[model samples]
Target: MRQAARSYSVQLAIIGSGMAGFAASVFALDRGIKTAQVGNTGAVAYTTGYLDLLGGDQHSLLTDPWRALVELRQHEPRHPLARIGEQEIRTALARFTHAVSEMGIAYTSPGETNLMALSPAGTLKPTCSVPRTMLPGIEAMTQGAPTLIVDFDGLKGFSAAELVANLRDSWPELRAARIAFPDLPPGQVYPEVMARALEVSTNRDRVAELIRPLIGNAGAVGVPAVLGMHNPDRVQQALQQLLGVPLFEIPTIPPAVPGIRLREMFEQCFPERGLTLVPQQKVTRIDLTDAKLRLSLRDSYGEVEILAQAAVLATGRFLSGGLFAGRNGIRETLLDIPVTQPAARSEWYRERYFDRRGHPLNRAGIEVDDHFRPLDAAGRRLDPRLFAAGILLAHQDWTRQRCGAGVAIASAYQAVKGAVEVIGQGSAATRG
Candidate 1:
């Protein structure tokens, strides 16, 4: 493949293909600024795609997401200022829904929280909301007290009977059973499973068909994590028309395709506007100068260099490689920026492997300013022109709070907006 120009005049270089990268590209492009997007793994592979505003109860974080940050800030002082509040979180969710919808992806709110849904493996997934496409209109059925757990045959990674037994331990009085469907793979790799399902089946309709028998028997219909097909609108219509019960989705296994699909939509939309997409290209070095910022990227084709007036580092956490770890422990990838975490890696976790309480891995992330710029050990900004977004610049635990997507959106927006201002001011200086 032909290499990208060795040196080009670009206004901004947004790294990572996740929400933060896509959001930054869109923001920069909207300002008529030239930008390039490069990253290793695309964010979609690990994202749930739903418009996550505040994870869990809005009221939980509303009173203070900053509480954790406030304490950490005194120690790290460089940690990014979290702009999320109860009301701001609400507005951000609304804005996210509108933005993605305008991109032609339809979504609706489930209006409930801490609900349960089914995974393809016939297991229970306690996802955040009803989700636009999957949740059922089962409230009426539940009045009769029918609780249905939807299932898919041949799905790996979970057991339906185990799920029911677990749920029964909690709500013994609610009537619930597993309903199976066809067409899912008996054994397949995660991505292949996702690609096949996206191509051949309608998860929504299959879920509806399975729950149809229990329509009146159960007041609510729960589906495997694969409840909705890739199409949100179709999933919604199917659930609405099928069982007259409420529907919910759950997290089942690793490499969730539903999450991947959502990420794909954002990635595809970015290039349509002329945003340069460099997949699997990892940035090896970053040198910031008074005049511009320079990046050296390494890929299979070898080293490809790029320079920009400003940059957005959205490469994500250790799992994504945006943050690096070794005997020295975890540190930010690009600048070796200091990270806030337990001095000993052992301090990073609770005694229980799955404590559900905050994990050290979640806390081990970069510290940034209110505008999302990384800071140095001295408590000063690393680069005035540099900005960090997404999980790379961290504060809260996304998985526990269920605000992974929310953090991605809020920080990505803040980074892009800040980049535009700095780039615009620099451009005017050069023209002068």
Candidate 2:
């Protein structure tokens, strides 16, 4: 028998597994390009699951994310979001959100105005779109309808009382309750386990039984987002029908159900749809000198290789090992690409911790050209076949601007668009 094949060829290679990397693969697949995605899949789980556009500035929140995008272009033209036209951004976000929905998790479409969504702690956050399971909470809070927010006894990080305490002023009818998780171990229960357990109908039934009695006169009942890891929509619907009221999920905390659902959904669905998903492994080396770019990394079995016509570098920021910070300065981890950062490490941050300008270090990353190709030190394209996306691109601090997911999806779209152009015709011909 032949040994397991260790090498594959594709039209596009995506170099990260975070939102941007995943978005690139989705867009490529939509374009009918053969694609492969490889990266460590941890950071996606740490996200709060709110897809923010230009939700706010350092000082205050913005009602109109599109309007914010317009102003962003005027001031920060180099910002990744600002560089892409609004319509393109809109289309890209809608496509990404729709693709994700089709994969499994249902999401509200991006709208004209940002929705004021709920945070784990009772504070409201302006976001472009939210998971379907969490939409009812936004609706309940906006209407000031009587609602009961419940938490499990041993669950950590999410507190029903904390959410209500902070939100009571705005939504006085909002109340809080805590109950023991049915059949859970005695101590330190996690949201992941709870969510997975909820995949079973009996488990959902046990939860609904406990929540129904406490939801008296409430228009909706909200619970921690442990509504089934695989099919949250089904689990949520079942709970709602059983409770006789609208049901919603509140974001628990980072590394909680919302983000886990996205990562898991990709793992489950991407392979079946003709996408090569290399989960939880780093691409050790990339060779771009050849016409067909080559990427290599080792798995438990042995060395694995991918040959692609074009590649997108969406390896996120420092946390995900996309950028490395050292004694000299920060550098792109994968290709050692030019990093646009402060002159010295001393200037990385402001003298004060909360300076409105944010840290200069946050703005540092590989700069990309109009087509999203990584630019060299003299601002020339590093290689026509290589492009960059996600937080690793320079000139904007995504965290403070509230455009992380927006940047990821939009840049991935543009990068993949550029890659498709390159794939259809040689980069030299496209340039010519």
Candidate 3:
């Protein structure tokens, strides 16, 4: 049987809970806007905990992302990052990372140059911000310091040997070690489980004892991101104290510890700060009226609805189920908004898999105007009160260019700014 629908009213409603949606909420909160955010479990868990701004260009990895943005603006004006001034992007990143740190997880503030962060595959990627637990690894790698990359007996995906082998040419002092996690059967292990276990002091002591003998003369120890889930910095500090060595984390596979920390932190923190957060829930229906927007969805409890003066759509690309690739063509799942895509599906991909330009299908998304409002077929705003953000905006491939976080954060800041303006006007009109 269907349950009674519960409704919420707010000045701004954010759809999608990925990096962009989260960033929009942060911006709105900073502006003192009453906000509600709704989204399904999206791509937040797939991240490496490294916040990437402009990390790469067509063929080369970028160290100075600020300069990369200059080139991007000249070459790709339609790109989401290019649409916003670099100062706004910087401010957005700074505010978002600061908020996350305040929530419990410590992250490095965004800086001028991209940090060479370690990936699960042992390859280095350029990223703007990293968790404090992972920062020492970057320093260790940069100095070619004697560092032991450790892996658990049962942990899969992240291999110390693989990391050592791939990085040996560049960092001759790198070494690999294996240890057994305390009180776990020697079967397949997971990062989340280890992270939670480390939160307990006894487990931290045992694990540190096991890794201490293996450290030898290594200046630092790198482990898969299995530090305490809630307070990773504290956990790393505790473990480092026990081992008497600087400790760092290498990113594990998808749904890793760092990503999980962000998800859990936001889910716990946002509501405390007065933002209505519907975690792991999708907006099933959206009804736009002249006065307000109505959003409907179902949670485990029952039916839920949100009515807001303005809405920001940060629903991500195909992965998050925001943009769907149909047999006929691509589509914006909610509202049937027109998606800017290739004329034919046949042109979606190139003949070669390793095409330098990337697939045309990746660029498929909804078009937005300067205000970040979604446009119709004639390039007119679909709704004065509706705004769009994140990778869902058309033009420029994020994966190939490595600007996912940059586009998401910067566009979200603009979207929230637009929403604030529209909501203020609406309120003033009602008063008049």
Best by TM-score: 3
Give me the runs in candidate 2 sitting further than 4 Å from their true place.
Answer: 1-5, 427-432
For model 1, the superposed segments whose C-alpha errors exceed 4 Å read 1-8, 26-33, 42-44, 47-91, 109-130, 137-147, 169-195, 198-216, 227-230, 235-249, 298-303, 350-361
lDDT of 3 at 323: 91
Number of backbone clashes in candidate 3: 0
Q: Where's the lowest-lDDT run of ten residues in candidate 2? A: 1-10
Compared with the true structure, the alpha-carbon lDDT of candidate 1 equals 0.62
In order, candidate lDDTs are 0.62, 0.89, 0.91
Q: Give the per-residue lDDT digits (tens) of candidate 3, residues 133-165.
A: 999999999999999999999898999999999
Steric collisions counted per model: 19, 0, 0
Better of 1 and 2 by TM-score: 2
| Candidate 2 vs 3: which has more TM-score | 3
RMSD of each: 5.0, 2.3, 1.2
Model 3 residue runs over 4 Å out of place are 1-4
* Root mean square deviation (Cα) for candidate 1: 5.0
Clashes of 1: 19
